[model samples]
Target: MTTALDIQGLRKTYHNGFTALKGIDLQVEQGDFFALLGANGAGKSTTIGIVSSLVNKTAGKVNIFGYDLDTQREQAKAQIGLVPQEFNFNMFEPVVEIVVNQGGYYGIPRQEAFVRAETLLKQLGLWEKAREQARNLSGGMKRRLMIARSLIHQPRLLILDEPTAGVDIEIRRSMWEFLRKLNAEGTTIILTTHYLEEAESLCRNIGIIDKGELIENTGMKQLLNRLDTESYVFDLASPLEHLPATSSNLCHCTLLDPTTLEVAFHKEHYSLNQVFSFLNQQSITVQSMRNKTNRLEQLFLELVEGNKA
Candidate 1:
């Protein structure tokens, strides 16, 4: 597969002698929806800043779609559209003009800029408020505006940092759908988000960064396959007085509430069907059941904490 982004032996150090990245090597294939996940202050922003040319790297090379950042700076940047973590636009400007002016930064003609701006605004569901000042838009609308501004130049690679932060569930899911359609249409996407479920749902590949190091880079399915334990939350039809006993000794059950039971078990030994059978034997009719969406969250914690150890 063709590489969309590549970083070789990337290293970064601030003037005060703070090392932000330590010889990191990573890659994302063309048209991939990749996730870069890390806890706060874990070099994620530093890595992104360097790739987007917002921050200078101390040592190492970065290539975007095979365009070397050093020798082909304009070519490399032209291929990427970055929606950074902060809202860097002018709050007083009309929403539509903000997007059109962004295209102007890339030297796009004024006439074509308006066309692209309209297309992006409509696609992002912000066309209705195009004439409104950016500060007048809701939090979710502001987030969508940033995305529209980023895409004004129609870049093939989109880098989003906390794209859905402060967005309500309905708006967040709508943004996810738009992103899915964009990725399906052949645009490569790199996402950095605190929402684990968002990563698990949208990204095909994931890389975990901790303390300025790339610890794990693999397919999302492969990373989740490393889990030996799986957990589920079961809501009971009636109030529960005690935790139910599982036939398998490896299974651990906890009472989350009077009517909620959480079960964690070695997935290899105790199949989900077996768990259901055991519950049936105990006459515990479950009102509803959901597998914990935080499986990746648990693995992420273990990996970061284990790296410290």
Candidate 2:
């Protein structure tokens, strides 16, 4: 499979002597939905900016779908669609006009751009607001508009930087579905987000940067499997007073509250069934249980902290 994006010895240093990238290398195969995650100032946005040609790279070879950024700049850029963290379009413009205008930058025929705009707007649930001024739409609608604009050219690769920020859960989930469909239709996507859970749910492969360096890059499932333990929170049907004791060192139980308990266990040594059995023995009844979504967050913290040290 061809690589959708490849970075070799990428480095970036600003005029203020602030280094944003530390010669980090990264790759994403064509058609893969990948996540580029990091805390603020970790160079995630810088890497993206360089790839999209919005920022000059200090030193590196960047190849997008076999087209070199420096030598084949236009071809490489033509393959990409970037949705930045902020809304950059004119708020006073009609929604359809805003989307179609983005296509003008790529030299797409105005008539064809209108057709593409219609299709994307309908797909993104923005058809009803197509004629409305952009500023009249809700925050989620504005985010969707950016996405529609990004895809106007139907580029092969799409880069999203915090695409769902500030969106309500319902709208965010809908956007997730739309993105999933886009990826399924063979558009390579690289997402950068502060929402760890969003990354965990949507991305197949992951790269985490910290302190201006890439600290971890691996398949999502593979990285998750490396985790030594998993934790779950269970709400009790009745009040429970104290931490529950476990027979094996593999299991650690803690009382989160009078009616909430948390259980941590080694994967090979314990299972949810065993936890249920143990609780049965204690005459404890569980009202509900949820897997703590912190598995990725936990590993992310470790890798980033390790990089710092």
Candidate 3:
């Protein structure tokens, strides 16, 4: 597939001398759901700002569908839609007007814009609220309104920043389903969310940024594989003294009460069999056994902490 968004060596710095982004590189393939993950103050927003032309980059290159942002500004911007984290519309305006206005700004014809606006509002389950004042809508409804507004221009690539932040679980899941359908039909999506589970479930490619730097970028499966290793747990029969301070093989362990233990291990350096053998020799009876799947959250934490070091 072709690249929908290509960013090379992207960098941004604020006037107060705070570097918001540092030499970041990223690419979202056409029709792929790419997730950009990062903590607060990470460069996720700055990267989106540059791509959306909301902020001027101190240095770097951004291309939307091979159109250079600097040289083909209008064309590049035309192909992208950004639904920001915060609402940015007149509270008194009717929802329909706000959405139609976005289409107008993109130079879409009025009649066509009206049709598109209605279509999206209905598809996003907001057609009934289309005539309502923006300030009267609930948080989740406001988010859906933003999504509907962004699509009015028929953008090929949609940049969603914390899209489901304030939505209820049902609405959030519905939005995800809608986005998934959109991607199936042709839109390339770039999503940034604090919810790692959302990214892990929806995004095929993942990029993690921390402290102005891009720390990890790879397929979601590849990232999870990188974290696969030894797994063992202890079904303690009773409370005991302090456990080992650290272990070369044990990644970490937590005491889950007086009779339960959760242990994480690295398979390359240790084996569950060895753990079981040791426990057996110590006469610790196993009450049950369980295995945990490799999670993106664990890898995210490791990457962020390692970069800090």
Runs of candidate 3 with Cα error greater than 4 angstroms are 230-294
- How do the residues 1-309 of candidate 2 rate in per-residue lDDT, one tens digit apiece? 999999999999999999999999999999999999999999999999999999999998999999999999999999999999998989999999999999999999999999999999999999999999999999999999999999999999999999999999999999999999999999999999988899999999999998888888999999988888989999999998767778888999888889999889999888789889999999999999998767889889888878878
State the lDDT of candidate 1 residue by residue for 165-281, as single tens digits. 899999999999999999999999999999999999999999999999999999999999899999999999999887786666799899999899998989788888988888888
TM-score of 3: 0.84
lDDT of 1: 0.94
How does candidate 2 score on lDDT? Answer: 0.94
TM-scores for every candidate against the unseen true structure:
0.96, 0.96, 0.84
- Which pairs clash (backbone N, Cα, C closer than 3 Å) in model 3? 230-267
Better of 1 and 3 by lDDT: 1
Model 1: ten consecutive residues of lowest lDDT: 240-249
Q: How many residue pairs clash in each candidate at the backbone level?
A: 0, 0, 1
Model 1 alpha-carbon drift over 4 Å, by segment:
240-242
Model 3 over residues 97-173: C-alpha lDDT tens digits? 99999999999998999999999999998899889999999999999999999999989999999999978899999
Query: What is the lDDT for 189 in model 2?
Result: 99
